[model samples]
Target: TVFGLVVKDYDGDGKKDIVLGGNFYQSKPEAGIYDASYGLLLKGDGKGGFTAVKPQVSGIVIKGAVRDIKEIKAGNNKLLIVAKNNDKTEVLSFK
Candidate 1:
């Protein structure tokens, strides 16, 4: 249920990419009573659509999950991710 993803050009290719973190509901019996949260990297196709690039696990525990993501500006060719863990804070970087 998260939105408003921040987009930027981290690779200097003139195409804006987006970072997102969220969860996908899993069926109780099929998924063994657990949900999946993921941190995703998407590259803009320059035609109003995006393609998935990187998908990583967000948390380790059952309740731990990623709530939000923000891009930190640290000069060109670098991007910082301020990820909100279940009850803590984490920082991820893309360079």
Candidate 2:
């Protein structure tokens, strides 16, 4: 249930990486809430392959349902912005 995602070279390795965020909170009582995902960071290998990186390592932790992901520029720096439901927007910058 990926509602938001962004792709970029976050590690400066000349390869594209991925950031995924999503969660399903609306469900019947019997079905329960679907919140297994805690966000995902996929590091690309430049050969069309990717490796999963943990949140602690990647520094991209998303909670609640993700709505959108966008890239923005702030003067000389570029940043990744994350929007979530009932949560504060997050910003990520890479060097």
Candidate 3:
């Protein structure tokens, strides 16, 4: 299930990027209730295309098993996300 979704310029590339947070695709009992292992950072190209980029592989980690997520503006006006994990919540800044 998707807890939240927002399209913004995540990479400052002047194109609309996508930020999605939810659990892995499944239809289990806790699908959207407890599964917190799905958050995606999709970069956008100058055109109208987007690419899913895993933060961990890129040296970043935004663990799932997350409960909720929201997009916000950091103090510097950059795109950021606040997510609720299993027992705690964390913030992730878009790069």
**Clashing residue pairs, backbone N/CA/C < 3 A, model 2:** none
Q: In what order do the candidates fall by lDDT, top score first?
A: 2, 3, 1
lDDT over C-alpha atoms for residue 20 of model 2: 84
Q: Specify the poorest-scoring 10-residue window by lDDT in model 3.
A: 57-66
lDDT of 3 at 52: 84
Q: What is the lDDT of candidate 2?
A: 0.83
Number of clashes in every candidate structure?
A: 0, 0, 5
**Best candidate, TM-score:** 2
List, residue by residue over 21-42, the lDDT tens digit for candidate 1.
Answer: 6553443665563334445667
Model 1: lowest-lDDT 10 consecutive positions: 55-64
lDDT of 2 by residue, 1-94 (tens): 7888889887878999988888878878898887877778899999999999988898777777887888888886667788888889988765
RMSD of each: 5.4, 1.7, 4.1
Quantify all predictions' global Cα lDDT against the true fold: 0.55, 0.83, 0.63
- Model 2: how far is 35 from its true place, Å? 1.2
